[model samples]
Every structure is written in C-alpha cells, then in structure tokens.
Target chain A: MFLLPWFLGLVFITLGPVLVSLYLSFTRYNILKPPRWIGLDNYVELFIWDPQFWAAVRVTFFFVGWSVPLVLVMSLGIAVLLNRGLSFLPVYRSIFYIPSLIGGSVAIGLLWREVFGSSGIVNQFLQGFGIATRSWVATPETAPWTLVSLNVWTFGAAMVIFLAALRQIPTSLYEAASIDGASAWTRFRRITLPLLTPVIFFNLILQVIHSFQAFTQSFIVSNGTGGPAESTLLYTLYLYQRAFVQLDMGYASAMAWVLLIVIAVFTGLLFWSARFWVYYGDG
Target chain B: MGLAVLVSAMMAGTMVPPAAAQDLSGEIRFSWWGSTVRNAKAESIISMFEKANPGVKVSREPGEWGSYWDKLTVQSASGNQPCAITMQSRWLAQYADPSILQPLDDKVASGELDVTGIDSAVLDSGRGSDGNLYFIPHGVFYFTLFMNKTAIEDAGMELPPDDWTWDDYAQYARDLSDKLPEGSYAVGNQGGAMDTFTDWVQSHGETLFTPEGEVGFTKQTVVDYFDFWEALRKDGVTETADQMAEIPDNIIDDTLLANGKILIDARPANQVDGHQKVLDAAMPGQELVIHSYPVGPSGTGEDIGSNGLAIGATCDENGTKLTEAWINFFTENPDAAATYSSDNGVVSVDRFRTAQLENPDTTPGQYQAVNMLSTVGPRAKSAYFPSGGYSALSGALTSAYETVAFEQSSSADAADKLIAQVKRLVRD
Candidate 1:
C-alpha cells in the first residue's frame, strides 16, 4: 500500500507528461484549442521543409562539436594539474569551480554578452593593443565560437568529476611505470591516458547531451534575435521559439521528439563504442 | 471509535462548506514591469486604490521589462495569473486567446468603465480576432530620432532639413562619418534594419501585414530596403550589423553628445525623459535635439510607427472600472505623471498633463521630445497589432536583412527567400 502511492505518483507525475507530449506530437494542438489528430504532418514538415529546423540542427551539432572536445580537454588538463601537488590547492580549486556555479545563468549570459560585444571590455582592451575588434556576438563567424568558449570556461563541473576519477587511480600503477624507467610523459601516455579513458568518454557523452539542449545563453546573448544572421540559433532555442513565440505546439512537440531520438542515438553510439577504448578495472 | 470517526468526517465536511460560502475579501495581487520611477508611481496608485476599497490587501509584483512577458505568459498558461496585470500592446494579441484570458465586453457595455477618453482605435487594437480584449494599455509610445547637436555642428553640417529624403540622409551620414573621429560611426542603428525597414515600408504606403494577417510586401520592396542599408554599410557611414548587435541596452546612456560617437539614435518617445543622463555625459558644450525620422521616398511628411495604450478583453466589471480609473490617474495626474516621467525616460501620453512639457526643470532633450511628438502626433499612424502570421513574417524580414548585411546572401536572394518563407508560413 505504501509503495502503491509512490508508484502511482511516478506514473502520473513523471511519466504522464512524457506520454502526453508523445501523443501531442501526432496531433495538431494549439493550447487555446483542443487537440485534433494530425497524423505525421508536423514530423513531415520538420524533416522536409523547415529550414529553421535544419539550421538549428546544424548549429547544435556545431556547438557540440566545438564545445564538447574543448570542455573535455580543459577539464582533463585542470584535473591533472590539480591531482599534482600545488600551492593553495584548495583556494585554486574553489576559484576554478566558481564559474560552474554561475554558468548557464542569465547573469553569466549578460556578462558574456558584455565581454564579447563590440564596445565591450574585450574590445576596449584589444583597442589598447591597437587591434580593432568587431562585435563578437553579432558576426556569423565568431558567435558560435564565443558560445563554445563560454561552455569551455565553465569546465569546473567536469573537472571535479575528472578529479574524483583521477584520485581513484591506484598509486601502485604509477610506481610500476616508474620501475620500468618511464618518463612522466611516457607514463601519462601509457597509464594516465588509459585510466582516464572511461572518465573522458563519460564526460564527452554527458556534455554532448547537455550542449544539444542549450537555450538560455544563446537566447539572452542574442536578445532573442539569433543573429548576426542566425549563426547562433541552437536547436533548443528554435524549439522554444516554435513552442512559445510561434505558439505552434504541434510543431514544437515534433521537434522535442526528434531531439529525444537524437540524444538517444548519440548516447547509444557512445555506449556501443565504449568497448574500443573505455577499459574497466575488472576487465 | 466508530462514533468518533463519524464525528470527525462530519466536522471536515462542514469546514469546507463554510469556507466556500465565505465573502470574497482577501489579498489581491497586481503585477507590472517598469523602470524605478514607474514602479514607485504604480505603488502609490495601488495604495490609493487599496485605500479606496477597504478589506482588500494588494500585493505589488514588479520587475524589469525584458523578462516580464515570459513570466506573465507562463503564469497565464498555468491559470495563476495575477488579478490585474500591466501589459504591452505588442503581446496583447498572443495572450487574448480563449484559454488564457477572460472577456470584458459586458463590463464595457454596463458602463463600469469610462471609455470616453480612451481612443477607439486604441481600444480596437486591443481586441483579438475573436473580439475579446486581452489587456489595457498604460500609455502611448512612438519612435523618434534623437541627435547630438554638437556632433552635427562638428561635422560642419546643418541640422538635417525637415524634408530630407533618404539620399540626403545618406549624404549627411557620409559627411558626419568623415568629420567624426576615426573610431566613431555616424549613426548606431538600434533594433536592426527591420525596424527602419518597417517604418520605410509603411511610409512608402506599403503595409507589412495585410488586412487578413498575411505578409503584404513584394520581394522587390524588401530588396530595395536591404539595398539601402547595404549601400550605407558599404559607405562605412552606418555601424555594421555586427557593431549594432554589440550595443547593450545602456548604450543610450554611454554615448555622450560631446564625444560624438553616436550622432543619432532611434528610440521611443517615452524614453526621451532619460536623455538627462545623456545630457549629463555630453561634452561640456554640446547641444541635443529630438526629431522625427527623416521623410522617406514613400512616407508622406507624416510618421507611421508603433504607439502604445490599448485596452484588452480581460477586464471584468471591477477590472474595467479599476483600469479606466488607473489610466486616467496615470495620464491626468500632473504631479504624479511629471515626477514619474522626469525620473523615468518616458514622455507623458496625456497632453493635458503637460506640466513637465512647460516646466523649466525638464531637460532640453525632454523638451525636444515634447516638441517633436506634438508635431508628429496628429500625423502618427494607428499602430498595427501583428496577428497570427506576424512572427514568421518578422523572422523572414529579419533573416533577409541579416543575410544581406552579413553578405552571406545577395539582396535579391534574400528578398526571394523572405517572400517565399512568408508565402509558405502565412495562412490567411
């Protein structure tokens, strides 16, 4: 009887919305009107004719491609640095982790906009160096890179995860490498790289999934304009625009399902590929 | 034990019945978004209303403007909307749908609201296609061109003649660009070319939306608009699209008249009051002027753009009465409006409450706004409420302009794409 309530709550609360959204994807529903069966019209249009949808997908992939690798490398680098003895290590760790707390927030987005904007602090400094800079947020070329930089700058969360994994490694493994007269670089290549492979894979999959759903920073940075010319129009942002701004609930629902499938496929691929490089201790 | 259980069940049932029957006097919540000055004035207004109607406590919920609509929309969707809300005209249409709002037609007919002073056009603008009003406008708002007088003088150019055409404006931009320091552009175009294009199209006797809510422009017209801006970009007279995108909301405050970075900035008339900050920042000896946009090829000497203040259908009997009273109080209350307007950047919509206009304490920029609005007031077009297909149309136009500005697509290609997109998206 006790478990029944929790089971029922899970069914109704957590699983219900997902089921409803799934149904809605097949219907022509605006919030104002009752939903009607529309079959696969939304999905058909999304795949065949929606340029903005394609644009969003392209931008999302670009963001993930640029951001995920950078975040992984940076986090791994920081984790390795912290794993070694350093002065004021706790303070440095705290300082590095602070951005993780504030990242993906509106304040951070505004700060990003200010730092990268034409007359922003970055450009002002660049001007002092006699290097004229254009608006970073406005250009098609630099906007995506700016967002990628923002994502990489907040690698503290991933770094913490990597740090924990780094600590879990047996010190005897390093001693074995030292006994073999291995240099630091050779030991890192032979032991550290293999040991960290699982963590790197985990971080890569997680970051890619999260990056696909990025909304707030791009939305705020672009002031909902998504320009210099739709360069930073991320997939989730487009979904939001369709759902809220355009009020095309049916279309947005279709997009949501597509996003789910994309994430699932990517995650499945990562799991499938794990056998090649991600080695477990017992194995 | 059975008897005790029965008694407890009866007690719970009785408790619910009485609560349902109780009188409807409790806390009432009112929410709005505005500047600090507007917030304070709104607080006083709420207090006065609360005092007038005893037994009801009012809670004030205010926030900065940008995030206000998103918050309100979510609340309305969840059926948790505040009893009263301050709404903008642009968003009134989207929320007026049946699921989101209540109707106020009965309240209007019953004479609960004094609608005589309110403009009928403004009233009509608030009505949804289904004939339900969704929100009441707080005040009128229209765009104006504000200039730094010192920049014009420094450029050795006379103040642009009132009838200056697009060609003349372009030439003036060239002159100003040459005279200004190397880093500064002649003009900073805010809201992008879409805003300027909309105004240009409207002035040229073309409408962005048809009567049936379809996009109403030819590909050629859009191309011409893009070409105009592209030429200016090529001339290096106007800030590039990238440069304009970089400007923060507070750019109006930072660009001083004396330093001459921005010669002219297009902004809302209501924001004219905030030019005091600009004046304070101006080089020691520069002057400022506020004027209407220059006459375009298609624009009659009249300005045609957005102005605020429309009533919505959500006002019930009490809501209507309260809203009418509130509008009149905000507009007609000289001391309140003057204090509010001076502190905030807006010019008072109510002409009768012209105390600030006549007062010597008002900034020159403020007076210039008053003068320009007075001249263009009669000629101002009734603001259009973009109905169903408007967002797609706006997106198309924005995309077209951005494509040309970024040089990713030629002007012709952008125009064709825009027209095709509009045709595909617009239902009616």
Candidate 2:
C-alpha cells in the first residue's frame, strides 16, 4: 500500500506521454497553441483524403513485404551456414553482423546513397558491365528496391540471433535424425526447423515492428523528400513530416497511434499463427 | 584532502564578490546550432559576453541543424526553453506563442535592443502572426544559382547573364546534359526544401499564400510550374526528385562542384562557403560563381529569408539585459561578426563590417558571394509571414511537382489535385 505512490508515478511517468499522444490523435494540436477537439477529423482526413499518408503506407508495406522475407531467409541461411564447422566462422559472423550494427544509422544511409547514386560505385560497376545506368535513386521502380537492399544487407543482427538459436538445438536431435536415415535437408527440416520456431517467431515479431517504425534510413536516404514520387517515404517518415515539418502535432499523433495499431495487429497475428508452426519443446 | 582543499581554494578565488553579484547569479543556459566553424565563433562570442557581464554565466548547448530543432521543440513543448536561443524566420511564428516564448516588444521599445542600423524589412521577418517581434535577424540571406564554370564551359556555352530567363536556362541545361558525361546531371534540385518551388512560384508571379491566408496561385499556375519541371525531367536535364533527394547535402555539393557531375546547384546566398568546399574538392583550379536566379515569367524576383536571435519572454530583467547585450555583441561587434560570417560565406548584417568582404584569406568564390549578395540584396524579396496551413500547401505543391516530374501523374492532374488539396487544407 505504501508503494502505491511509486507505482502510480511509474505508470503515469511511463505511460503518460503515450496516453496523451493517443488522445491528441483525435484533435487539432500544433504544439504552438492549445489543442482544439476535432473528434475523428484527423483520422477521417488520413483515411479518406491524404494521398501522402496513403503513399507512405504503401511504401512502408512494400518495404516490409520485400525486406522481411529477405531478412528472414538470408539471416537464417547465414546462421545455418555458420553452424557448420567452417574455418574462421567467428570472423565471418562478425563481418556479417557489422552491417546490421551500423545499418539503420545515418552513416549507413549516407553510404547507401553513395553506393546507389548516379555517380556512385554501383553505377560505375554497371558501366563496366556495359549497362548504361540512369538515376537509380531517381526511378520509382528502383528506389523502393534500394531501401529493401539496405534492410537485407543489414541481416547481421537477425543472423546473430538465429546463430544463437541454432546453437541451442541439442546435438542428440540431429543424431537421432541421422540414425533414422534422415537426409541433410530432411534433418534440417525435422530437427533444426522445429527447434528454431520459437526464435523465428520472436524474430518475426521484432523485424516487423522494426520495419514498421523505420524512419532514419529512408529519411536520410531520401533527404526527407521521399521521392521518385514518394516511393521511399515510409510511414514513420510521413509521421515525422506531419509532426515536425508540417507542425501538425495532432495529425502526427493520429498517424503515430495508427502505426501503433498496425504494429500491434501485425505482432498479434504473428503470435496467433505461432501456435500452428512455432513448436515449443516444453509444451 | 589536499586535492579537496586546493579545489576549494580555486573555487573561492573565482567566486563572484557579493557586492558585484546580482540576484541572477545561477547559470543561464543558451543554445544554438551551426557547423563546427560557427560553433567556435559562437563560443568565443559567448565568452566575450560573459567576461563583459560578471555574475551571469551563459552555458552553451549546440547541435547540428536538424537535431537542434527537434531537441529545442521537445524542450520548449515541455516548458523548458532556454532563456535565449537562435531560431529561423519560418519557425519564429510557432515558437513565439506567448504561452511558450516571452514577447520582446517592451525591450525593443525601451532601446534595450539596438535596431537602428538593422534593415527594417529584415526586422519584419521576425514579426509573428500577431504582429509582435519574436526574433531579430542575425544575417540576411537570398537564393542564387551556384555554377560550375568548367561544366558550363565544357558544354561549349558561355555563362548566362545575371538576368537570364528560365527558358534560356532550360536550353542551357539541355545543352549541358547532352554535352556532359553520360552519368552527369545538368542541374539538381534539392526537392526536400520548398525553396525551389517557392522560387518557381515567385517567378510566375504567384505567392505561396494569399493576402487573406489562402493559397495564392491558381490550378493553372501550379500546372505550369509542374510542367516546367516535368519537361526538365523528360529531357533528362535535371536529377529526379528521388535521385536528388538521396544525395546527401555534402555529396550533392561534391557532385556539382567536386566531381563535375552537375553543373549548377541552387542554395541560399550564405552557404557559398560550404559550396566552395565542394568546388575545391571537384575542381581545384576551376572558378565557382554565384549568379542571380533565373528570371521566371511573373518576375516576382528572388526570395530572401534569414535566421535570427531572440530573447525568450520568460527571462528576468537581468536575463533580458544580457540577451540584448549578446545580440548587440554578436551582430554589431564588427570583429566577432566578421570572424563568424567569414567562414559562413555570408556578408555580415552590419554594413560597416567589411572585413570578411575584404579579407585576403577569403576565397575568390566567397568574395564573389559577398558581392552577389550586396548587388542582389536590395532586390531580394523580404521575408513574409508564413501562410496558415502553409505546410500542407507546400507539401501538396512539392508532391504534385515530383509526381508530374517523375511521370507518375500529368501536370494538369497534379496541379488540379494540389489546388484542391491546398484549398481544403486551408479551409479546415
């Protein structure tokens, strides 16, 4: 009973801003002045009229659609490959993980720009192959791909987690598979795959959340223009534009809440479906 | 114990005398954002102010430009704005909300602020929507086209005159695009900022906002602007919005002046020094020049804006005095202004401070920028109040421009949509 104050403090301090943001989502607050209650006007505008918001949503989904699967497969593949008794495995692991460590940073975004820009290394390489490259960053078709490649290139963090999960699988499980005359592919499917389901579920939830809230790389990469016609404008980037650039804090709050709902729903869906495929040894 | 005694002795020696000490003895925090060069200059200026005024200490909090605003906004929203701070003209309106920032009218009227020599037009830039002066202009700025002489010369074209038309500029761009290396762009627009669009709109005799706070341009005017960019995009004369957007500011500088991948770039007049670095990198021997913006159909001429210093309303009397002194010291102190403005590639607002303009250490390009600003400064449009729903209007225009330029939508379609969007945005 004595700790009630502390508990209330913790709850209010931690959740106060979030609750305020949620409430502000329905109003017209520009941070400079008092918030005017506008009911669901902000949400209505976002859903019914705002093309930029829709563009951001489309770009975000495209980013997640391409990036999530690529990250999952590449990281899992790299982790599985590292699980083998390869020479200098630790060095390779570090090398693969380095991009992940720095991938979401402004520095990496700057690097991505350099690599894919018109006069960048990628263009120079393409020129060597007798391919005349125009602006990769300028094209609607290729700009989204550039962001996808950026996320895929940073598979290092997921790879590390997958590696740890791979290590946790008992050697006896593989041995049993081998005794049963299981092929390498079969053993991987029956033993390694099932055993790693929980980790996969965890990674899926994490990656989706990370991908949904991505802002820095796209912001930096696009220089806050989000172009070739808003192809690279992510959801968070739009939220930032609304919040800071436009100074429509209330609208930005609404967008933030919407994003929260999006992440929540996606995460919930992953957890719900986990029961179907995510095997738990304890259960 | 010996270390503690020594520390106490040093502190006691440095402690302010009670008779000399005012009631405001605690540290007063101040913040601004600028490059490392500007930061050093600011530090020196603050030190000078502190030395001149005892009992009051000013703490410096600075960051890079983008992060600086974010931090300051978050802080201000939480009722924690610094007593004195730097702000941009566009942002003064939002930040000067009486609830957040204290008004400076009393100080200005009492002659606490020396606004005698400052340009009245420039002073008006700091005025909020409520007609209260919220900030004071630190430096005046205008937009200009910084050109790579080698690239233009390489294209076998002479440099356009100071008053070249957009049509002539487009022709030159087309010629440059064809003549330059395959990977090179004729010109690149920084699509992120509204400067390019604003310049375009002004050239067409349209303003971003109307007198009554509506969008000034018609649907047709927007279409014409979009069409112009679309033509450039189709002709391969300009970098796509995505391409231009992806280029970091530094790399964009390098691409134009350093690598000669681009022949022309548009930037604020004050940024000539930074652009010179790009030129120095790409073309060490080549001369860089700042020319007037291409004349648009409307002939509204070039847009000029500024960043300025402001004293918060929350400051006490002593704080107010210190704020005035700081502003005077920073702006009117010829040597301090020269030192800061020299590296900044901008002319000091103080007309008497010719040190930067005449400095032997100043680059040829820097000197040219100074001359350009002086020559064009009088003609530049004074800063105006940002329109209500200006962000939405600007965003709609930018989106329309990009959409049309990238061939995702027709110019007419984009223009119509933009007009409708702006009307709706302003209406609400």
Candidate 3:
C-alpha cells in the first residue's frame, strides 16, 4: 500500500508519456491532426537528412564536453577552499549556491546577455584593459563559451555535495599522514584524492546527465532561434523548435528518443569506467 | 445644416446597430497577444462591448506574442480553444482548417458578421489556401524603415526622396556612415529579415511562394538579396554580425536602432509608436521618422499583412452567435475602435482610420503610421505565408545570413541551403 502512490506515479507520470513518445517517434504528428505512421522515416530524416540536427549535435557535445569538466573542477576547488575552516563559510556557501538554483532561469539568461552583449559590462571592463572583443553571446565562435561559462558558474550544487562528502572523510588518516611528515599536496594526492573519487564519480555522472538536458540558457540567450549561425543550438532547444515552432511533433519525438539513447550510452560508459576509478573505501 | 450632414455621414459609416447588441446573451472567451498597454485597451473595449450587449459576458485570455501560438495550438488540440482567437494572416494557413478555426464566409453572407467599410482586397487576404475566409481582419500592418531624424539633420544629410531606389539608399547609408558619431552604424543589419526579403522578392516581380505553395523565386534572387546587405555590412554601414545578432526581434528596447547605435532599420509600420517611445526614453532629444521602403527595380514591393480574429471550430450555435456579435462590435463599433487606437495594426475600417488621423490627440508616431498606411495600402501587395512557411523561412533566412556573415558559407551556398531547407519544411 505504501508503494502504491509511487507505482501510480511511475506508470502515469513517467512511463506512460515515455511509451506514447516512443510510438510517436515512428509517426507524423502535428498535434492538430491524427498521427500518421511513417515507419523509420522520421529516424532516417534525423540521422541522414537534417543539417540543423548535426549542428545541434555538434553544439551540444561541445557544450557538454567543456562544461562538465570545468564545472567538476571549479566546484571541487571551491568545496576544498570552503572546507579549510574559513570564516563566514555559511554566508559564502549560500552566496555561491544561489546561482545554481537560479542559473537555468530566464532572468539569468537575460542577465547573461546584458553581461556579454557588445555594449555590456564585460566589454566595458575589457576595454578598460585595452582588450577589444565583440559580443561574446552573439558570435558563433564565442556564444557557446558564454553558455559554458554559465554552466561553470552554477558549480555550487556539486560543491555542496563534495563538501558533505569531504566532511565524512576520517580526520585520523590525515593526522597519521601528518605524523609521517606528509606535505599538504602529498596528503591531498595520496589520501584525499583517493577518498573523494566516489563522490567525484557521483557528481560527474549527475552533471553529465544534467548538462545533456541543458536547454533554458541556450533558449534564452539565443532568443529561441538558436541563431548567430546555430552556435548555441543545444539538442533540447532543437527538439523544442522541431516540436513547437515547426509543429513537427513526430520528428521531435524521434530526436528525443535519440537523445535518450545517447544519454544512456554515456551513463553506461561512465558506470563501466567507475569500476577502475571510483573508491568507496571498501574492498 | 453642416452639423446635420456630418452626423448623417457618421451614422452611415457606423456598421453595428446599438439597439440590436442587447440581443446577445451568452458568454464567450476572446484571446489575444499583447503587452499590458494593449491588454488594458482590450479590456476597456471589452467593457464597452459588454455594456452594449447587456447580458453578454466575455472572459479575457491574454498572452505574449511568442508563446501565444504554442498555447493556442495546445488548446486547439484539446478542442478547448477560446471562442475568438487573435490570429495573424502570416499564421492563418496553419490553423485555417475547419477542424481548428470556423469558416466565416457563411456568417459574412448571413449578416452575422459585418465587415462593412473594410476593403474587399484586405478581406480577401484573410482567406485560407482552400479559399475559405478564416478570420475577420480588423487591422492591417505593413513594413517601413524608421530613421533617427535628429542624427540625419545633425549630419547635414537630406532624407531619401519618396521614390528612392535601393542603390540610392545604400549610397545614402554609406554617406551617413562617414558623418555619424564613432561606434554608431548607419543601419541595423536586415539581411536575415524575412519581411525585407519578401519585399525584395516582390519588388523584383517575383513571388515568395506560388498559389500552390512552392518556392517561387530563383536562387539568384536570394544571392542578390544577401549581397545587398553583405556589402553594407562589410563597409561598416551596418553593425557587425555579432552586434546585429544581438538585437532581438521582439524586444523594442534592446534594438540598436532604438538605442541610437544605428541610424535606420526596417520594422513594422504599426510599431513606430512603440519604437519611438523606446528611443525617446533611451536617448532623449532624438527624433524618429517613418519612411517607406526604397523602391525596387520594378516598383515598390511593399507588402502588408493583418492581425485579426478567428472563431474557434468548437463553438456551439449560441457561442458562435456571441462570437460573431463580439467581432462585429470589436470591428464596427466606433467607441471600441477609438479605445483600441490601432494598437495591433492600423484600423482596417476607413472611417476609424480617418477619425484616428484627424484626431489631434493622436501622437505623432500614430499619425505617421496612419498616414503611411493610407499611402501604402493601395499599392502594397498582400503577404501570404503558406502553412509553416513563416517559421521555416524565418529560421532559414537567419541561418543563411548568419552563415554568410560568420564566414561559414558563401552567399550562393547559404541561399542553396535556405531553399532546400524551406522546401523540406513547407512540403512536410
């Protein structure tokens, strides 16, 4: 009886729509008309025909590649710095954590635009140092970097997780290392790094999944067109355009399934690799 | 005698019978897309409408321009769309099917919907691919260039003549570029603007799409159009590709033209007042002027579209009657027209347009817009976008221009890609 609610949610909320979408992937549906089955045409068109699909793939992979590692490194670094018995730690922690909560919001997207726009604060600050550059969020080469920076800026959620895990690490091991005349860097390299691997693995998988699904930052920054030469065209944003703007619900469904498979493969690979790297401090 | 004649003319111009309005009894929902100002105006008009029809009730469903279509599409899929849906002619083909919007030709014939004083040509613009009238157009919109008059005067440059050509306009921009303040460009880059390209195609005596909805213009036309803006962009007459890309379509405040960072740009004629307000706030003492687009080789290719109301297919007999009555009141009632003040587009009815033009309270921007409509309405061709063509062309054009601007592709390759992508989207 206790599991009934969860079971119902699993069936209706998650599984039902997923199955419906899977069926829709093989059909031609415009939401207004009855769906017409087209077999593998939607998938074929996506894989072999659409240039925008390829552009979206390229942009998304680039975004995920740069953002995930940068986020992991920055968050781990911040967490370590904050863990050093610092004053006003909670205040700094809250200040840093706020961006993660609001980073995906429309307001942040607009703020990012204002900050990276040609006449924006970033340009003004750069011009002060004689570093002339065009609008970062508006150019093809630089637009994705702005979004990457946005993803990296929201590293606080991972930082909080790492901080909790760092707190759970035994102080006796560090004290023993100290008695053996271990340097701070050597202690970090030998004990701290090995102990933090599981938590790092957890954050890595979470961030990779999260980065793959990232939509709102690109949507807002690009104003939903994925413009400036499709530089900011994330995979989810392209799916949204296909479904809503062009009213190609079936094709969008196919794209969604493809994304699901890609994410699954990535997660599988991560898990497989974790056997070599992740340490739970157990035999 | 003159006063009596004037009163008679006014009464003859009015389309609705005030006494007959009280017969409408049922409730209906009227949905529209607008900002707070327009919503307030719409509410005032609805209040007037409800007052005229004592037993009638109207629930408002307001939305922003971008999300309005998505919301309406979802509501339509569920067969729960509002009785009256605000529709643009550009988007009419997508929803013109009888399954989505009701055919209003029978209503027009039966006198259920009165389109009196509206031009038949404008009315015909509302027809779908099946030749069925899907909506009653209450306002007409056309594109025009808005210039910073103060900047031009300061630079000692005279405005282009009424029959200025594209070459003349380009040279004018080039001339204006050398005299403008540093960091300001001559024009906003409009190479990707679908409306401007439509005008370009039309002016060259070619249609954007045929009656059967296929690509009507050649690839050469597309290349030439891209080259026109590319030259300006390369010469520093327009903003950099990055700066141009930064200027969003929907936000009036963020535009380079509005911020005085650019001298001229093409925008909808009806948006002059909004753009003027933004410019006025952003840079005080800057005067803005609306001008017709530069004429093409054949002639002026100015094209016009409309914002109008369509009755949803799901409405019952009574609901349909209420909707018809509301449409009649909204379009034909002089007070409602006065309240709306052509907020969406220029008033479609001749009498209301004349009234707005003659009214001293009309702002300079509104007066210029109404006058411009009067000037171009006769010559302007109806802009007809096929189902999904608007979104497809808009995306393709932006992509094509961005590729060219960012040096990813040549003009010819971009044009080829644009045509191919548009064909796939529209044919689908």
Cand. 3 Cα-lDDT:
0.91
Clashing pairs in 2: A228-B242, B102-B313, B258-B282
TM-score of chain B of each: 0.79, 0.85, 0.94
Name model 1 segments beyond 4 Å from true: A1-9, A28-30, A85-91, A119-132, B1-29, B50-59, B75-84, B96-112, B116-124, B127-138, B249-251, B254-259, B301-356, B359-363, B388-396, B419-428
Tens digit of per-residue lDDT, candidate 2, span B279-344: 667767665677787888767467776677777656776666666677766666665676676443
Question: Residue by residue across B275-334, what tens digits does model 3's lDDT show?
Answer: 888888988999999998989988999989998999999999899888988898899888
Per residue, candidate 1 scores C-alpha lDDT tens digits across A1-283 of 8799999999999899888999999987656556788899889988988777788889889999989999988999998999897889888888889898888999999999989987789899999999968888888889988888888898998999898898888899999889989999998888888988888888889898889888888998887767767888999888887777666677789999999999999999999999988977666
Per-residue lDDT for B193 in model 2?
Answer: 43
- TM-score each candidate: 0.85, 0.85, 0.95
- Tens-place lDDT digits, model 2, residues A116-150: 88878999999999997866776778988989999
Q: Each candidate's iRMS in angstroms? A: 2.8, 3.1, 1.1
List each candidate's DockQ score.
0.34, 0.32, 0.77
* TM-score winner, 1 or 3: 3
lDDT of 1 by residue, B1-428 (tens): 99999999999885552212322245645677777767877777666545544544567888787577767766766677666666555556667675566555664676533344444554555566677765444355567676777768877877888877867777887887888776677776532344566667777778776655656667777777778777877777777677655554354664432245677766666565466455646555666677667776666433333223223334355543444445444444444455565333333344532665778887766666656655665666643444335567677777667777887999889888887776656532
Docking class of 2: acceptable
